[model samples]
Target: MPKALETLVAAGLMSSLIFPVYAQVKAPILPGTGQSVQYDTEGKPLTASESSLYTGQDASFEATPLRYQDNGDGTITDLNTGLMWQKSHDTTKRNLTDSIAVVEAMTLGGHDDWRLPTIKELYSLADFDGELMKPKSGKESKPYIDTDYFDFEYDRRRPFAGAFWSSTVYIKGDVQNFTQHGGLQGGFGFNFADGHIKSYETGKFFDGTTIQKSDNMFVPGNYVRAVRNTTTLYDMDYVDNKDGTVTDQSTGLMWSKSDSGKRMNWVEALEYAETATLAGHSDWRLPNAKELQSLVDYEKVDFPAIDTTFFEVTPSQFESQQDSYYFWTNTTQGDFKHTAVYVTFAQAWSKKNSDATEYFDWHGAGAQRSDPKSGSPSDYELASEMASDYISIDNWVRLVRDAK
Candidate 1:
């Protein structure tokens, strides 16, 4: 019995009873969602947010909002616009070469992986044939999200749209290829300054000219829209045709040229287009909204109306103030009783609307302005200063000719 007891004690099974043993203590482990909380060798918990380990596939732990999408394709899609563009897109797209490079090198959202959108991806946001008057007032969905991407210091909504360039090559018939619109749509089927999905509409305007939707597709030149990208600075130069029509070099499209003092109403601008003559060229017509928008330079705020070269002076008699750097487009909104869309050079933005009555008089089957010397004036006024009598209210008018 003594030997057996000694054996049990040696085995330690009865050692606790034999020796005055203390209670054993164990640390408690908490249950969680399996996301590991980091710790040092001493077992102290780390303060970092609980996240999955960096798997090479989805290693974009530091990407910022509107910065990147971990597509797991070794490349990430730009969250700002859902474009998975290559680095080359930035280099070749337009004036955004430096901007893209800077973004690429940034350690944003905690990761250094960012790139411009490819043509296929970037143009995917176009709203071809969508309503121009209310271009971006649509519902949102998963595959399509119309969110503003440009956050430049000059203009908060620089990336929204005017016109942008895409990386895709537009191959027209007869080996005539063209650069894709920044919105990747044809004609003015280009994308909106604000990101939104668009539905198709008849490309034809009041006149018989074939206008293409501002999308990535090809059609006739019946209608034209405007666009600009961060990669380039678009300048507007005016051609002073002593005749009725004036040519806007920014779009290579002409509009009825008005003298700085001629206060012809909308009718006059149309008439100027109707009676224009340049180097034996007739067939001139007043530019529609998109055609007018094509000439706006968002970066340079001076002389926002049309191109400076086109005008001896900006028209101030129209609704928008000369300092406002915005003017009316020929296009009218669907049902806004007294409002019309206009472009502002202050930010290269095309999303502002002005009043109709104060800046213009729709008398004599056309439009007229306080400044009668300028050719034709669209009927509109600035939102803030409803005073139409200000002759110094600078504005611009452009003309267009049939593409034939």
Candidate 2:
């Protein structure tokens, strides 16, 4: 057995063996977030002292680094996930139905097994090194994806038009009215332009006079980038170490069984994770965007959209409304320093409008969004005009470390 496995086994035994003993399971490897640069709370590049001050940030630890190879043909291969991708996406945007049809008819790279990627698979291409440029800043915005490895472009007319469709549907539906059809079925998509995973309506749109096909309609649609060899579905195999930590045999990562159990700003959360010592290990660090998102168990559409069996989760109360909390990731938003990425393990709430008193789940559980790194939730303006009136500046923390 490997040294890491032996260590985990010994640790498990020492802690009083629990039911379902530690066992290895083969699972898809998750690629790193491709974020190498460290940032301070303000989004400025971190100095050595600042980096040390914030010891357990994303750049401090390394996972399986992202590796991609572009075939001379019109395809790119992600070495980490063993998935081949279309080098360039169709310029024309389509609804979910049409997007699926396009992939069915696609015969790229001399192969016919092309299909749409799941939210996780598509998210593997996200690169935090890219910068989000302010709209009308007269500066070109950098995309959250690697433009060199894959073809990418921004819609000059619609600044944030880079969302690519995924096969996974947002379980809570389209309460946000992202498309012409309001309050309808929706599917998840990744917007590389601004760096978020959101749900877009999948139904066809109706013009003032009549319903229109996606090809002729001007309603909201998403780009398509076909992928192949997606044989593995999303799965997480977790084992309870029974010593305040859990091991995911699939990804070879061990995590704190419980969260900080309190709300904190991004900097505080980072420091909390870095300085944490748990389960007789001191190498814990805050997970990057990808690492943190991998823990979300989308199967649970209710509160705490994770496997509560091995992890402890607590809901935060706001105005008598109990809601799942947003957990911070070490990655800073590409476009701005004031914001950091977070994954909503449960319902992502939004006010009905700026004047509304009630809040509803605008984005479904497992959605990925950004939050202000510091200050009171009310102190900052909405992260984006498209965002809900509600925002949560103070978030939660969960620490992770490579099993050794």
Candidate 3:
């Protein structure tokens, strides 16, 4: 017997033609299956009841907040906010007064979703209509900016202007170089002349004057734009040294160290840290000197102003290298002295020379020096073998780990 006929006969139901006719009509399929059902391509998928939701709205409703520019992605951006956003791009450092004012103005609008823009939000706003100029509000909806975003009522005694301020603090100089680590080089492309976007590193400019080789001071007043951090850094574990020295758990670095007065070389200290096998980590390096100093608590320092809970150290750590209190730093000064710098929690001062200052030359690279106090020659061998010819005398280093 044929298989189809046998099944039909056993079921005691359909004839052979009935089975063929049933097969001819395709079975109903569930949604998302390959089978086609009814759906409108240009409209949303909705049941008859759901389709009636928007039926009673008046056709004469006009959009509020004055002007809107199509964002090309089916969304629209406001021109008022655009102007404010541009001003923020012009800023380098964060100005709480400006930022809060902008946020307050935005909150007054009907849109409650408006919040402080993130770094990327502001970063994306760069590179307006080519040539570093901002997009203007014209027929092109060309990056519309409203002149009425700010209230200059206090300026009645002065002159009234239509321009408004942005929440972002724009740094006038090529501030990109300031953002680098270890070396101050390379920056994202930008148009220097008109503040436009060009390439990944278009406006690469450096204020060589801001960097002091004589002293490790970076000019704090140079305009710097502060960007609100969007992504929260997570998975970071802080090392609790329990003394006065803290280390980064991920990279096994002394997260931050205080320098009172110490003679330790940064390179040697970093090498020591790199070789350290703490908690199964071996990639420790010297924390940028600033990272070390951040641990200091100026309000409370018996000897060195430092946070006691997070660090591990004793007065003996500064006494000598084997039990030295002095710590080394990777930061070099532009002094004619071959001398490098260090930070010791022992005395709590940002000094020019370390403990072994008498050992190095004034301007020469070799390890030789004329004593300032005794006026005598001295040959000072490094207390530790972890030093190179490039290393300066009396340089002590503290270990640092990358923040996880």
Candidate 4:
């Protein structure tokens, strides 16, 4: 099946996966606070959602904290997400084919539990807040990863080589490299530059029966990082703090009791969250695009991608009031200054909703996408503009704080 037609189903790992799967392992922890806020066209805060700090959102810094412990015996452990990692890469620079074989055949520290990590698993190790950073010695530049946790070589020969191969051949039903901002053909990879995860192509072409490398053709390959499980990774596990907040058991992120309760522009949404003191927590902030999209449930297709039972989403009965299904994300539309990304909880992703007028690129109905940060209120023609208590708006805000 074409990758574009595929949606990530919440099922057991495919039998074809080369990595060894523990029943419920959440190995290869994700790094980065999930805040990639940048400047807008005028050099002002790009969107109200963006933070002045390079660390994106301050609350996220506490939520998805970069906590790790390096085991001298060639391994690293993430304290936030209990995932173990191989401290270094192959350094030999092999294509995707050899890379997989190298990890599978190896026995590290009298243990043979090592295997290539999935795209999601591989991403759990990135530290975006530290990208392009320089050490005290004044080196060229550094990737946004914590050198204390994982070992990565700054290959001068292959400058753009932070792209690491993931075990997932197909992601979200699209070939790893088939997304709007994707990589090669064989699988997906995590680009460490801005900490963006996209589809990466391997040099080989899968000819019905076999996977062959593009030896005749020049194949610029990515890195290989191995992962192993520490414990089970949960889904939809949340804890209501009685203080009007909900904490996710799996990701360790705490969310607001409800949304902004009204539609707002990008700036307004940011301010609303920044000033919010609900439940006695004043460190609330708008979630980035990826952070917000993480709430989606790919297994649910009828009403929306989010878990309606957990979140207060009243989709059918809002016609009489001023409300919008969209929420703003701090992610800029690629590098466009005027536009930013958003997600609609009320939309669904499917073949029937592929039409532009009916759906967005994500196929998941509104599929968190880009829209102008500031535009005419009628850009979406929302009814809120007509209400006396309403003002110009584009999206809503869903606040989150670091879970203590």
Candidate 5:
């Protein structure tokens, strides 16, 4: 048995027997991405044959389907995660400090226990079916979340202001030479407008051209939607099957014990997952964005921000590179079909616009970012001329399937 599992079993947290997996744990089950539709490389909707061409896309596999119940009284409950959330968030944004205070005083639905959700809990509501329409495309942009059960709005003047705050703060020292103007003492947020996760500054606001520190109560803050758990929240429950696969009892999903061990473009990674067979199971598929993000152990303050006991993370094969690599997800970026989402296990590297030689952790580890669906890693070197661009195009893969 893995040491992690042994430790859990020893603590009376989980049983040594895996027969009744769900009965032995109290962790939150991660909900699916709510992505039933599939798109091609050009951001165009695809039919069955086209979806087959990209065999391991998110729609190609089954997961815990997203289900929500609107409680008529300004609250929404996620049937999968058993989390009740605020149906509509306050239009007035607040910084991380104030956001927490506001939730403490909130009494929506006659519940005073509403609290700021962690990044994982906030992300459970993300739905990939929404599209980010091009500016002046004469089309309406859809939010990455379901608008039917919850209300969402974005500032027409500020495109990125659609981001909603989570309580999980970015670890300070994990960043290397991160020198954004006004600095980055910030918490993470999920931008439903563009369908990605990023860290936003809690202290300063970048008003188009210049960064200014916020003095007023709410100029530079992100939106917040409060959540309260129905059950005691526990850490992820991972059980080693001893058959080259690991089962996450929390999410009811099984994962490959090791990654592909090499980098590949999005299409290649998808096909690789479709054909992968391990531990006597052939139904493995590439995980969707939410499914894959569940594996990130944000509590770990180091490179490869994941639990390494049951799962094997591949180290960078390049000379003198000590960090791990990003892993691809089946979810495509809604704004650009040619780009897909990837979660960084290693430091999210960026080069200075003036000096390409100097690189630093710009987005921190475990950030959900996007890259071109198919491109040579060298093709992005010129694109890195902008300090805001991330550096990886090719990423590794880890397969997942619905647990039996």
Candidate 6:
């Protein structure tokens, strides 16, 4: 048994004899390496290890046993997370404020606990399937979601109908410019068409000088998919599989225990993930931004989002603020894929995140400066640059396998 398990056992809260079917332990053993496997360049799922060499495969992550339960009454329940969701997503035109009101007042499938999902919860639904939102190029990439289970529409048809609102409002004070009607502050959301997570100016008002008030809501082309049982959303844990692999029971993703060790550019990162093998499994691929962000422990803004006890925490050579070993994510910046998105697990926006007293675990503590990943990851003392262009952050790599 791993030391993480022993610690959990010592706490006297868990027992090996009693395994809860749906209860999420911190880390669970990863599945689908030996017997169940899929290959890249090949469309069909295969049985047995696809190849012996450390060749990269296509980024395919499918839920084993199909976790969706289509409850005849316009509702779907994800068995993995035990969260019930509205089956259909309506594109009815409404502002963010109205959208929230509509969902709050709604009673779907005879259940009344439906509410807007936090950015974290909303992002959980995102799956990095290229075909789901097939675009001429990534410029027109499909939505960052799985349309098979829900009535999602992320094709290239409607340019306006791209983003979906999350309950989490963007509080970072660094955004100099974006399309916010009400005010400068943006709201957190997932862009399906381009597969990026960002804060859209949720301002419903339009004024030349500035937004009149602060009602963070999407203007138009946004919809709501109500969710229930939020209390059960995060009963998850991380497990060191002891096989150079770590499994997240809550998300059902198998990740490489160690990181890529070095910082590489975006293109290099992908190539590294493709040709890597760990713990006798050759199916490892880079994790997307949504996947990377999910591991963050919101409560621990003072330290890395993850528990260093289980995950080998890589501290930065030149300390800045709360910065863990920055890892590369498959999710890219919306303007261009040249730059990719990465999670600053060691950070929290100080002005936004109200924690004080001095702990590097919480980022956002310092002023919103140019992220170190923007060209100078190792240079801790790089003077902050306020360029208009969006520079992609340089990142290390952590690979992931799909849910089996």
Which structure among the candidates has the greatest lDDT?
A: 2
Q: What's the C-alpha lDDT at position 223 in model 4?
A: 79
Residues 90-200, candidate 3, lDDT per residue (tens digit)? 223222343444454542213323444432233223211111122342221112122232111211221111112123222222222234332231122211222221111
Give the alpha carbon lDDT tens digit for every residue of 132-231 in model 4.
Answer: 4324546565564677667777656544456777775632333211233232234556655434444444555443122344333456677787877643
The regions of model 6 sitting more than 4 angstroms off are 1-54, 58-67, 92-97, 130-149, 153-161, 171-174, 177-184, 203-221, 231-233, 236-261, 266-285, 288-291, 298-326, 329-389, 399-404
User: Taking the tens digit of each residue's C-alpha lDDT, what string does model 5 give over 226-253?
Assistant: 9986543226689999988998887778
Residue 358 displacement in candidate 4 (angstroms) = 17
Q: In candidate 6, what are the lDDT values of residues 1-404, reduced to their tens digit?
A: 89998898776544423432233323322111111233221134433255432123223333233246666677776655566778787667455677788898888877677888876776666554432323455654444455566777642356535667777654433233344443344455665554444554454322323334354433443667788875333544678888777887766777777667666765566677777767777766766555567665544434455655666655644244333355666443433322345665543322222222232322221111123223443433223221222222555577887646
User: What TM-score does candidate 3 get on C-alpha atoms?
Assistant: 0.28
Candidate 4: worst 10 consecutive residues by lDDT? 383-392
How many clashing residue pairs appear in each of the predictions shown? Answer: 71, 2, 58, 17, 0, 22
Rank order (by lDDT, best first): 2, 5, 4, 6, 1, 3
- What TM-score, over all chains together, does every model reach? 0.32, 0.84, 0.28, 0.56, 0.82, 0.56
User: Top model by TM-score, which number?
Assistant: 2
lDDT of 1 by residue, 1-404 (tens): 69988897777855544443322213211111111222221223334333221110001112112243342322334433323333211212222233344555754333455544323234333321222233266743211122333221111233333333332221110111122321222211233333221211223222222334454343321111111122111234566667655655534555555432342343334344456565477654444433444454322323333345554444443323333333433332212212222333321211113443333211100111122222223433345422223333234334455333
Once model 4 is optimally superposed onto the true structure by TM-score, how far is the C-alpha of residue 402 displaced, in angstroms?
5.0
CA deviation > 4 Å runs, candidate 3: 1-267, 316-325, 348-392
Better of 2 and 3 by TM-score: 2
Estimate every model's Cα lDDT from 0 to 1: 0.32, 0.75, 0.29, 0.54, 0.74, 0.52
Q: Which model is ahead, 1 or 4, in terms of lDDT?
A: 4
Show model 1 residue runs off by greater than 4 Å: 1-102, 105-128, 131-250, 255-282, 298-301, 304-307, 314-326, 334-339, 345-396, 402-404
Regions of candidate 5 where Cα sits further than 4 Å from its true position: 1-29, 172-183, 204-219, 230-234, 316-324, 351-358, 377-387
